[model samples]
Target chain A: MSQKEDLSLFVREALLAGRPRPEIAEVLVVAGWSQGEVDEALSAWAETPFAVPVPRPRTVVSARDFFVYALTFVALGIAAFHVVWLGFLVVEMLWPDSDGANYWQAREARNSIAAILVAAPLYAWLTVRERRRLAADPGLYRSAIRKWTTYVTLLIAALVFVIDLIVALASFLNGELTGVFVAKVVIVAVVSGVLFAFYLRDTDRG
Target chain B: MNRVLFALMGLIGVVAVGTGLFVFGGPGTARAEREDQDRLMAVNDLARAISCAYDTAVLPEAIGVTSFSDACRPTNLRVSASQLMAGGLLTYRRLSDHRFQICVIVHDLGRSLNSAPYSDMTAGPEGAACLTRDMQG
Candidate 1:
């Protein structure tokens, strides 16, 4: 409420978010306060701690926390699906069709499967590590973890899908591909687009 | 008891969502699939048509070199002619007497997903599709 309180809040936020001290001056400037005013305000707040009693430890997770839970499960889902899909790809490649239509098709499918087989699990691990890191923080303990992991995973997944979609669409748009390739592109777009949409929507709303 | 009830409710919600996905195929699935079938079949027909369009009446089926053309690689044109609507725009290339290239390609969304399963397409001439889509890296 007071200038001192505002300065303390600013310091707390900046420190918590790991911003450099030099940037605090910029932050103060942006907030339309002079450096002297901000420093004085912060000093006062630091000198006088809040007099309220300690609050109860959190038991029930906030919606953001629950979002982490949901997203973790969703990651598992994606990992599982891709794992199976990768297996199918391996099978197709090992026993590729003898009499040939698309020679490179089988090979491509095989490599694609292998790519997901490696990336999905690695991404999932990074996410879990971040989740654990957040479990200790008082305020952003759980949230920071979930958000970081979700953001990273979402970005990687989106990039992967978008690139793949472009590749798939190339054939049909160019008219060099057959109707079936077009159909495959359509299926991929529909399926992955739905997942991408859900990820984005939840990220925004949460 | 409350926790148990919450768990039960959550379970019900999960089941409902799962059922909806299964029964309805979610949002644009059916529509996408309807359009996709033409694209998917194009792969099949492209291979078949290419084999047929050979200057020689030789169907590659007699030999062992024909599978569905569902991979997206070196793709340039994807026109949907009335003829392709019924059959397909399959073509063949004879590099030499014994060593020739018999292939077909159909463009579709699934084929577009060149990350894991489709990325393999970029390994060959079909990789042209990959080049077009992912020129950055």
Candidate 2:
């Protein structure tokens, strides 16, 4: 067993032998384990109501779980793209060139609108269904893939936020800080910030 | 509940149908809208250039010359519609003195071109595809 596992086993045994957690932690700390390590080791058995360690059921991601997750993330991806597209639309409208509106802007707006129209309602339905499932069995939150996807989303959002800042700063330095540029920066920051907030909350809750 | 599921399915069907209709029916309107917007942009560019050339010209002989074309070409302006120039769908011509005519083949005549900036422009012939505006020297 790994050192941490060994520590956890020792802590469990000590707890079962009626040794106080604090006393066990102190002994481990004095035996050269850091206080943090000792505390971490002790925490493994903190909530156990019995002397024997309970075996946690292995989380099996069934096909239905995979389907729900796939749908949810796809919908979220569409929603993110739509929001960014809308931001571009806003920029074009606010800072049109000397000529005026163009065909590309119209086409982009139409495409994004169509995508959001289809995806948003579907996302809502899927989310509601998942929420119901989660409410029924909170253990569904422990799905490894679900947690991994959420963390990956959080990472991507962080990267986007940083890139947005760099772009804004570059625009300002280049004296290209037009209304459109400002609007785009604000849009990216807000979208990424919201996503980060959401996933961070989910991770915390989990 | 089955009722909620049925209602959601019904809503999804409605959205799908609505989106289908919009997607199928939208191309023509979208094309017209895009064309109108392009025409407006081209007109605005040409008008500004024409006004600049007219103001800078010292003689009538110089009017509607190559210098006028040069003035029409702005650094940032790009006219993609061959109709606007090069005699494709629209024709721009100098009609004696300070008068000019921008003749366009518009698919939708019902669309009012008498909006801001283009309001000074007057339509030519009831069924003919042409517009007339005079430049001040």
Candidate 3:
């Protein structure tokens, strides 16, 4: 049995020996027993395993579905970015390169929109992945803080990618839709791509 | 107990339907073909809208945007998927009839290509909010 299960069994036996719950809790803690172990053990004994049917396996989102959904968001985003960039270029060519109020307002709106869509989807992915992981192995995911932190970190990378996007967009908005502009976007894409691929595989195992 | 089972059964049903479409459906079945047509029509419409910005054998406003499969919206709306697409997309747009902007919309941000700063941009991988209006809606 695992540490938690073993401790739970011990605690259950001790409590049945006429020890009060609080006393058992204290004794378990004093004996360097983790709170999780104590809680698990107590709860398991409190409810008869036979009385409560086992939790059947749940089929969460499949890997293929996840991948397809992910691909669409990425493609649309890239397509939209290029569209706006070209829009700015045409506008800039027609009108002089002037840092006017209308331009700034439009720019801000674009950035804000990008952040909303990008961040929202990343967050959604994080939540779905989290649920999947939690269901897959409760013990590993027992550390609530760790689970949350990892999710937050994934969002952070997404945030960075969005920030880079804004910078690239700003460049285009300012009429920099040139070779150098495309090159920078390429670089950012590569870096974030590697980071995203690596983080997902590593976080689940840990 | 019944409730739990019902919930599980419901989940299984939805998943079953989704899988069936992906597996048993013929290569470009009616549904897939229709979707493709929709996406293509949208893309062609977009391209036709701003063809004045591009110089070539000015192909008539083809309806390529009408060809996107139903799978496009949900899939393209995810961050990880967008990240992948950033590397493979290429398109052109005209700033005006006089000037053209050919941007390689990568998966980084969701702003314009000109020189204006989109400080309020919520740029990210899961969206094509700004660039999607091009040769495809």
Q: Tell me each candidate's TM-score.
A: 0.30, 0.53, 0.24
* DockQ list for all candidates: 0.02, 0.05, 0.02
| Model 1 misplacement above 4 A | A1-142, A204-206, B1-137
Error of 3 at B85 (Å): 40
Candidate 2, overall lDDT?
A: 0.64
Compare candidates 1 and 3 on TM-score and give the better one: 1
lDDT of 3 by residue, A136-181 (tens): 8766444545534445546655776788788888988998776645
DockQ of 1: 0.02
TM-score for predicted model 1 compared with the true structure: 0.30
Best-fitting candidate, scored by DockQ:
2
Return the TM-scores of chain A for each candidate in numbered order: 0.39, 0.71, 0.32
Model 1 lDDT, full chain set: 0.43
Q: Cα lDDT for residue A124, model 1?
A: 54
Interface RMSD (Å), each candidate?
A: 14.1, 9.5, 18.2
Query: Residue by residue across B67-104, what tens digits does model 3's lDDT show?
Result: 33443333332122223234444233444333432223
- Model 2, stretches more than 4 Å misplaced? A1-53, A96-98, B1-31, B34-102, B105-137
DockQ result, candidate 2: 0.05
